[model samples]
Target: MNDLFAPRIAADPSGWNPHLAAVLADLATTDAVIAAQLSKWAHGWGAPFSLGSVPLSAVYATHVAPWNPPEVTLMTAKTILWIATVDDWAERDDAAPRGLDHLQEVAEGKAPDPHSALAGALADIRDTVLGAASSRRRGSLWVKATTALLAGMKFEHVASAQIRDGGPPPALPLYLHHAGQTIGVPLTMATLWASAPQPACDSSLARLQPPLESASQAIRMANDLQSYERERRTGDLNAIALGASPAYLRTQIADQVRHCLEQLRPLLTHPCPDAQALHYCLHFVLRLHQAGDAGHLHEREQQQQEH
Candidate 1:
């Protein structure tokens, strides 16, 4: 697993951070149960597209393992797989609105039968995560985040349709707001907070808001940078596709990540375990993108095909 963090110095990637590399080295190892459960659930959920396309192990090792134990990692993996499955479906067809409706109903506490496999997977993830939450407040926050993610997805679908119909892309601020939620950073954070060890220092979500937003923005920009080519190829919506040069986009991404790290620095020095955990989560995501390994499910497929 050490190879996972081996410096790609040959690239001299503008995003590389030594501290982030150290974090990756420390947390790259995953429990066998996580791997096994990921495989089992991927198959059972009828999400062969995820197995064939997305870099699931890489995503888990980088994003989920650092903040969670084996059981939580497994649960997080299931949720991620479900999200990826839904994203793939959304990209391929016009079913996203219906899917989002089903998810919204589930997130609102209704127990209606899911209308599709994607919806069913979301319902299952909601139940599993709520059952594992350390407190009712955290569970409630998770539901709200899920609903927010659905809304974001709906927004993306609308934006994509507009572009597909020959309209110009949305302005940068509007795109980032929608993209942040569509990227599911808030939902992922809620899950991490929910399953985190009991009584974490400075556990109030309010306290972590600024850093979360900063980190999420960084992740969103990094994703745009890393996946720009693939998005262009697929006629997909990306922040970079909003008419910016690659050089300009890279600069914005670097600035965004720097801001996130600055926000995290004070929290890390504050002796709060929850704040520290949130810091770790944000840093992990930042470094994953810095490594230039962060991309959408379809982007990974494109890489596979090219190779």
Candidate 2:
């Protein structure tokens, strides 16, 4: 947190903040991995995301964990796309099977229902994360996060269905609280902690809980600010779609992000690898919004494959 207040260090590779630029140069290499895996994940997992759309490697992987081994990077990418693909599936077509009904159960090592690519992806991701976790604590955190994420999605899903059927949306306060989980930050962060084995803060899921809450809410609202129109048309749950003014939403985002950073400050003071990774995410997301690339925050917009 003090670093957020301090002047930028001269050593930052990019002129952006330290976390955003620390591994700035290496994101391209990870971009290659995201590309190659997307193709495989496309066919292999029946991924709802397109294989042709290239990912901004920074938003997906490099920004979170450039220091991760390629194998862990693969797992991280899988977890990300899996969550995004399901969210997309839910938004576009509710008639089809979501395959996410038992997401937490599957993530806990149950066999994915046979022939369901979405479930299979979760199973694979879980196996990889468990294998990478050096301690039971990390694995437990991943499961807890996954469970909470599923619960959040379930809450929003019901709200979407209600609105689609002509009912009123969830109350603003409840909607805002659950909205961030639908963006998938908690699950991804926990996965990173387990897979990258962010050694500095693995002792307890409690270590990251406060900042994680702030980051997730900030990210969810960031998307809501920009995607309100599309979401309103689709009858999906969004703060802006529910009549939150852009100005008000922006205030909420700033408050959440500021609170997140302050909570992360104490952890960052030590050599916590998890803090470092999450710090990068917090700043990169805000910068993305500032640059209008925050649409990438939604994940459905990334449609590229590097030649």
Candidate 3:
């Protein structure tokens, strides 16, 4: 994985934050492999919701491993989307990253500041990927978050020189809301939800269908179709785990998740806006499935392909 996605450094590449680089390389491979596999699966199933989330998750695996700041911002944005789109929204929040204290520090741009380190990495990433256009420019939500973060920091003179001496950039005031908290550089589930726009009831309920229906049919499907239990276990586990609240709450939540899934399931048959959107959807479902169940959803898909 390291060899596969490792970026070539001009000199002493591996030595330059070797640990971080190794992690990044692993993430690149993981994401790429998952994305490639999922892409083939989507085509075969002719199902198109936001499968793009798989690649985005792969993208996130890179950010979380070594705590890259720019990647953190990207991860936060993705989390925001995930919480907004998934049923059992609260459960999604719990599974995602938390807190923005680091982001605030990044905005501040002080030396040895975790925030600064993160901010600098982001700056470097932007420069590498988007060129100088990353300098004080806001393009996408991620870019905007970066820009806002950079603009909000207060640097001491000593820290300022360190930045000149090749350190991380200052922090920003970017706040991603989650779990009723407004945090900077959100890496948590709460913060991720905090950053997302409020979902209307209709939208929220539509997301619940796949898991609900899949769960409901699991036993019957298993008896009628021997492979059904194994194949559907992932979705069932996710639904049950996420729906575990007070009895009344579970009922309400299950209803909503089922409803949402029903509404959106049809969209899976239609063309997605693009690969990114598809990837987003795929990533969310996979994550929920992975976190709540085992990797059965992905595994079953793979088995189907091999056969």
Which is the leading candidate under lDDT?
A: 2
The number of the candidate with the highest TM-score is 2
Q: In candidate 2, what are the lDDT values of residues 69-161, reduced to their tens digit?
A: 877777777777777777777666664334456666787778887766767777888888988897888898888888777777777877788
Alpha-carbon shift of residue 35 in model 3 (angstroms): 12
Q: In candidate 2, which residue ranges exceed 4 Å CA deviation?
A: 1-24, 52-54, 57-59, 95-98, 198-200, 293-307
**Candidate 3 regions off by >4 Å?**
1-116, 125-138, 143-177, 180-270, 273-307
How high is the lDDT of residue 277 in model 2? 77
State residue 269's C-alpha deviation in candidate 2, in Å.
Answer: 1.3
Q: After superposition, how far is residue 78 of candidate 1 from its true place, in Å?
A: 1.6
lDDT of 1: 0.67
**Ranking of candidates on lDDT, top first:** 2, 1, 3
Each candidate's lDDT (Cα)?
Answer: 0.67, 0.72, 0.33
Q: What is the C-alpha RMSD of each candidate to the true structure, in Å?
A: 5.6, 5.2, 20.1
Residue 183 shift from truth in candidate 1, angstroms = 1.8
Candidate 2 positional error at 27, Å = 2.4
